[model samples]
Target: MAAEAQSEGGLVFHPLDQFKIYSLFGENPIQWYTPTNVTLWMALAVFCIVGLFVFGTRGRSVIPTRVQSVAELADGFIYKMVEDVAGCEGVKYFPYIFTVFLFILFSNFLGLIPGSFTPTSHIAVTAILGFGVFICVTVLGFVLNGAHFLGLFWMKDAPLVLRPIIAVIELISYFVRPVSHSIRLAGNIMAGHAVIKVFAAFAPMILISGIGIVVTPVSVLAITAIYGLEVLVAFIQAYVFTILTCVYLKDALHPAH
Candidate 1:
């Protein structure tokens, strides 16, 4: 139900909901929805990550080539991020954290490609990821801190009479984490795509009109600039999600803090 906009160059840019892509199946005409495009792109993202890592490290060498060097750089970056955010104890969770980071980063980048759907743009995908982090953080808190983790919701610093009120607010905030986390990523990607589509729709019309020669160059530059910005956004969003996960894990590990 998103609206389409006409840019200065006369291109009609429509904001299509990629999540609506579905499949029909079964007797009685049951609609079995399959996020085919989303699933395929997500799978591709995973494949790319695995392929790069495997191929990059196939032959261990003291003198690394460009690909190997890039792989090592990524590994060190994630390792340091995990260590800094969740501390040395977080090393055990490195695999999960790294996987989540790469998955999101790749998905965001993939969406920028023409005709590719961004799985992360859908609420369902983002919600699932957020829920996974929520569950892990909750379980980790109990496992690491025991019943004392409940203290995170109840402020012992508050006066005894005010403790219940503070606990209620804290509990609400804790439950809202998944909602906020998922929506932030989804909304940002959705907005960026919508904007890019609108700009792209205009480029052709501008080129077709002889008087609009100036508009053609401007539109081209705009598209190029936006593409670069999208790349930056993709990485930032991934880092934000990872760091937030680490922060949640930290709270679980040191509940009193």
Candidate 2:
């Protein structure tokens, strides 16, 4: 009966609430802050990026070590993505795109650690990332294309009768970018983690039941496979975010195209 109850409970899905503010300053307004696991993950993400780049580049060797080779591969991957999406003209923006991708990727992967929180799973983090891309694209659009970029929203070149309708739709889409971008990342990470947690919560139960012993290996294997999948997802999401930024940059450079 206990085994049955445990098995049943294992099927119950519950989300772990990991968000919390860790500090408040009574004496110093500037020091008042929300402490969260998210913040730690973000810090770690930044550290990993800096460490990898520094370590990877330090040797400057003709024949690279495995670590250096891996780093160079990552660098080249982002560079090629920028070139593909934004064109050769887009190479100049590679730095920002690369940083954004690596930060988000590392942060997402870090959350897969047993106790670490995923910053990208928080709306605040995703929103900031999305907003940064939005602002950069908007600013670059005007700077590079001048008044011509206004056509992106105004539909000035549209047929005289269709201009107003087209502009309205374009305007709506423009405003939706940040919200959609942020939500997509947050939703994906949150869902992935939730699923993994659900599976993990089942592992022990399956091990404890006499019947569960039969299923224990299967449950363990499932967890292992899903974890691997989540790792892949981390990279894919980062690539998607970075590539989208490149696409936006291209729009900024040539809105009409």
- Candidate 2 residue-wise lDDT, 1-257, digit = tens: 43564576544444555443343323332332454445557778888877778876789898997878888999999999899889999999888888889888898888888766888888888999999999989999998889999788776557988988888888899889888888888888888887777666676766455777756677678888988988998888888888888888888988884
* lDDT for 103 (candidate 2): 87
Q: For each candidate, C-alpha RMSD in Å? A: 3.6, 4.3
Give per-residue lDDT, candidate 2, residue 68: 82
Clashes within 3 Å, all models in order: 1, 1
Of the candidates shown, which would achieve the greatest TM-score relative to the real structure?
1
Look at candidate 2 and tell me the lDDT of residue 39: 57
Off by over 4 Å in 1: 1-11, 17-35, 159-161, 207-216
Q: What local distance difference test score does each model get?
A: 0.81, 0.80
Q: lDDT (0-100) at residue 179 of candidate 1?
A: 90
List TM-score per model, in order: 0.85, 0.83
Model 2 poorest 10 in a row by lDDT: 23-32
